[model samples]
Target: MIGFVEQLLRFASHIPTFHLNVQLLVDFAATCEAQLDRWGILEDVDIAIHYISEIVTNTSNGDHDKLQLALSSLYRERAIYFGALDDLKSATEHGPKPQALNDTKHTSWPSKAIHAGRTYLAHGILLKDTVKAQGYLNKATDLFEKVIAIGSGNIALLVYVCESLAWMCELGHDAGAEPRLRRHLGSYLLTDILDQQNNPRVSTGKHIGRIGFCYLCLFKKGSNQKDLENSIKYYNIVMNSKAIDKRHPCRCALLIGLGHAYLYKKQDKWAAHCFKTATLLEFAIPALRMDACFSWAKVPNIDLVEVYSNALKIAPQLAGLEYALSHRVDNAKLLKNLVQEATKAAIAGNDISLALMWAEQGRGIIVAQMLQLRIMFTHPGIPIIQHKEPELADSLRRATTSLHQLDALMGTMDVKSTRKLHRDGVRWNHLVRKIRASEKAQLGDFLCLSIEKILQLGRKRIIVIINAHGDGWDALMIRKGDNRPQHISLPTSNERFSSLRKDLFNAGLRERRSGDGASGTTGSDNTSKVKGRAVKKIGAQPPPPPTPDSILKIILVQLWNEVVHPILQELGISVSTILP
Candidate 1:
């Protein structure tokens, strides 16, 4: 799965960013690291390391800055793991090399600064030496400030630096070199950027709300009257901003910030009012809600069990919920409830893959693995070696279990445990290699065919992949034997598509409501005949006027006419004679 996902990511790197989900890829990478570390397969760890490095090396012709960021992130993760495992030599070796930033032509200065800061931050966290840690932290802070100063026009870089700095401060690694209020200079700078942008009402409000969070951080750090005053000022700006939408998540965050500020000012009534208003908001940001819950918990008298419970029911992955529950409530039943809610939330969020990954991490590894096996075996177009060689599946499962057990035992790494892990890992690798060889023979290919290979299968044929990008859709097409995929631009832009999607959703809601109304009137004898005719009429309603599928077909036809047909004509396909 890791190898397959890596291939997809590498392929995506060659395409436009609209077609890729970078955060999803990062989450997958994190999952891979977590699973590999949990299983303690030292051999496969090297394979993963090599695979990620290969991505970095192969992506030089692509987006250099994004590629460098990804490479730095991977190195940072590896270094953190190695340091935690007490492998100082490997940790140092895995740390981002300053030489990587020397290529000014290929690498942007912002990218270099961000990567260097991240590297130093990772090292500072992992290193046990306080003096070295402080030095690294200072260096990181300096690099971040440099990027913030130089990359003012680069919103993305500025955001990354500011967020990283905020997180570093939260981790208490800032070394207290700067004054408490001045420590968050990056945050204030971000506020300036937000202030300059002529953004929409809701967007500007959200930006300002986030800036208010920076002041909240200062208040947390100092707890002085001046800090409290500054925090209140920002919170008031957010709350009074006419640009804020009532339903915006930023409104919730601002209220939460105000709650904290009020709490600091020892105004329990105002604090409670802020917390209550925040919780009542139509669209609550999960992180902010968690903070609100934590704040309410700190109050001398208040009941938040219902709030936390219901909030978790909505989004169980909300940060700080677990900690508050563990320390404040500490009930096993509640924890179990949280786990169940999280599992359901993951599935509901259209991320079944993440749910399965979490299941393996938690209590149901075997169950999740079995379910995955069933999916793989039953899924069309997917090759499964388990059907042809059942013994191979059994062997693989056993090897995996053994690997996990060994990993658990070797968590506290030492020379003896390390050697044992390596030995077992080698044995595991031999089994996997043999299985892969056999599967290759049976399946003819170990993974999905590339676009180039797929295009080679037939003449005068095109393989079109429709991808959803935010509110829009993009079609990538490859004609037979084509060297590159052609992008087919649709006539309908993202904003238009978004409006159409909303219309479809509203129509669906109306249909459901009408169905419910009919259900309640089913037994009325006078209306039975009317209901029968109504049902017949509805059944014959010409396939429900322009559903989302039909809308997409319209766009597809537009694409075919506007983009693909021209290319086909250029390729001497005789489009005049070709039939739809």
Candidate 2:
């Protein structure tokens, strides 16, 4: 009889007709009453009556159509179970019934409430109505509380309640329903959920990644360094686990998270390495293709462009010269492609800021190439005023103007002050200043000084550290050498003065390794040692490279010759040697 009741309930749950199920349940209730009468089991008969009454009351009052369906199904299943149990009770009333049959009386109002509440919650999610969904969740929680009050040690019920709350918090964040969701996280025994003993559900690497990410989000909301550290700790655990296959979704998020953490902490090189590594891994995974399309569409390929640009900017000697000579044409083409990709993404995302940033970064690259070209072709000793080619001067003027406009647009874009993002902004700002200083020379000297001052003072005001590409050398001390001043600081040192300076040397090396360019690696330790010896060797040697005046002339001449000339050629503008 017990086995028959169990089978009947299982079958009723899968049935299609709510009304038929209810009718079947009503007939089964009648059968139970008859068996109880024959056996004289009054207590068993009374319990079955209450269960039937509760189901009927809830079903009749249910607000939604789906609730009506669920109530009818439950009514049918309840009828079958109660009828069979009543039969067994009648047969055993003369003696003792089985424990299962005896326990049937305990499943009463609370069980019905829980089932109904859960049904409502599921329907709400299906309807995509958050407010209605939360209302149903409240109902479910109330039912769960009732069960607990009645001392029901149903682990499944407890787990279900906890899982519901956790999801509520996550969804609430996505819906912009709350500013912080961590407060609700404590409601769930997440640790216990992950525990194999308490949870029969399988744990996946993605689950671990979610736990880590939740913690990371909490840390981001506050300045709790410990929470941030713990976030990284959990990420490491998941990444190191055997469950974390390269093909897993968790791998890409974990990599991106680690990169972000490093970047936020002002670890640019490490952050770049992580970002690059994650990009490679993400590209390999077919599932992440959409994510890649979205992310790459937002930002320009500045990281790659900067890697090469900074290489030439810093060390005009050695392979830097050769790299600039060979890659300028190809690099310009790549930058154009990146701009197109970014434009497409911007249009797709409807993000005006991202579109502008990408556009400016692309323009910056073109300007940078022009600057490089001017250095290559312009007569070594001539000033702009003395240059015989009027076309060259005009091209230089036009490129400088374009660069200024690009700078202004980039500067006005809304960039988050994350370490990487801010650093990128700062690098662009510095490039702008450099361009302005190069174009107007003495005329822009005051503005250049003001920019430097702003940067120096801006340090204290910066609230977030962002990963800004390029050598990020605005704060580095300039050492005079040859025609251009040499950068005298190492990148990534914790020293207050040198911290923001990223190694153009290592950036070039990685760019080459990633097949972007030829290697222009500068061993920092070796360079430092060599510099120390050189300074000692020439304690009071000839005065350092010419004052800022000579440097300015050289920069202006280079900008006019390289950037402006090519742009004019592309635009079909005739060039002539004449003073503006």
Candidate 3:
């Protein structure tokens, strides 16, 4: 068959008639598509698309067979193989020739239904048009019912139908029909039970993982104990099943689902075990490992803060990892609460030095270091920045600068320029890593000052920390010579800050409108006000008291009034002596 197709291509250039030449190219493209369908050759399918485009362009509108071939090449073969909907779209642009041809053909009802079902499945899954996908799937189901009514004993056709329908059901999940679709999924999976187990082709890891995922989806859809049990059963079947490819990405997800099931079942030990095992999967991507580690950290039975800490180190800078965590984890609280708990643990063990080291290894390393500096500088007798080990401070400053550079590279590298500077980034990363490791080893625990140690170094004064987050701020206080850190709730919330900013923005808009309204009066004050508003509107400078520094000053006074002054008063300090 391959040789015959090659011969057709070889003779094409020798044909004299332009019409015949175009027909030969069409034939060649159809042959290549047939080869692709037979052998699943993606590269051949790509080549076929190019040829089909050429023929469809040159062939006249009345060339039904050529157009039909092009449509089939795109809608059926190429779209399915490549998962790119552009060809399907192009095929649609060529009219419904392929669908018309399929209707006229003498193929079996089951065959036609499965083919149509697959085309719709590709459209739905790839194009993300849930409504169109679902509508076509319904049409496919009716056709499949007719095929079954004809008493066809085709196991392959039945399995294909079941698989397509199962996928549509899964797709409907994101469209918010999860519970209803999951109830129907069991029947579809049952249709392929024999094939899934005994048919060697159907028993591959990918198929098994899909079946497992259906159950996992159901598990997530329900809160009952039975849902958890079923999820665990199916996931275990996939995990423990023989001859399945362990390196597949779906296996990572399957493991994560299994871990979540165990967690819901109150099997904390099992859940932790599953998550840790998922993290160790050699083939799993870093994003998957990041999730596994984050989930593992949330399990109360495990004290693997170091594992969570390390996972967090790379999570924020990686876009996909950050997105995944944003959906499933309270990342801000996770880091803050973890820090607080680590600090308490260290205090309990009388090893505050270890707590400081832990900070440098995790998500808030830079922030923790800055806070440490604040604690040190606020001490009455502590030496100034330059005087406190000048060489070490300089090295730290350089390391901090390199860290900032690394962040910029991670956040801003365009795809076109990445290749050019890829080697440079790697070298910079290696150098930075080496420097940090050396600093940690040489400075040991003292690289980060323990609150107790810092407070003891100077005059007896209390150190207060206000950690701001997206949702709210956390305040921690440590008196000089105190062991335990005191947690205080801040008066300001994210909502309040956001509301304040919004009001200020509205006021700016109002001022700009007022300035514009008065500008035409032709007075100097009005002209000056209009000019000032224009400057502020254009971001030349913020309008007067609404500047960032002014906002900060306002917030500082409010904080002192609401929390700081009250604490000082409680500690026997005169509130009148303190200036806000």
Q: Once model 3 is optimally superposed onto the true structure by TM-score, how far is the C-alpha of residue 154 displaced, in angstroms?
A: 9.7
lDDT of each: 0.51, 0.40, 0.51
On residues 268-358, what C-alpha lDDT tens digit does candidate 2 reach at each position? 6665655555544421222232233233223433343333222222211111111222333544554454454443344345543333334
Give the clash count for each candidate. 0, 19, 0
TM-scores of all candidate predictions against the true structure: 0.37, 0.28, 0.47
- Candidate 2 vs candidate 3: the TM-score winner is 3
Instruction: Give the candidates in order of TM-score, highest first.
Output: 3, 1, 2
Runs of candidate 2 exceeding 4 Å displacement: 1-189, 192-202, 282-302, 306-580
lDDT tens digits, residue span 1-580, model 1: 6667667755765674524344444455566555433332334344444445545444433343354455445545544432332333333344445665454444456566666776666666555356677666667767766665654335444443444454445456674532532545445556575545444355445555555555566667656577577667666766766656444545766787788788878898788788767755434443455556556656666544444433432232221111222222333343344444343444445444333333322333213222323343343423365666667766756655665666567557775555445545444444443544463435422322233334464356755544333334434445676645454434445566567667767766766766666643343433344345432223233455555565656556655665566556644578664224
Worst 10 residues of 1 by lDDT: 319-328
For model 1, what is the error of residue 1's alpha carbon versus the real structure, in angstroms, after optimal superposition?
A: 24
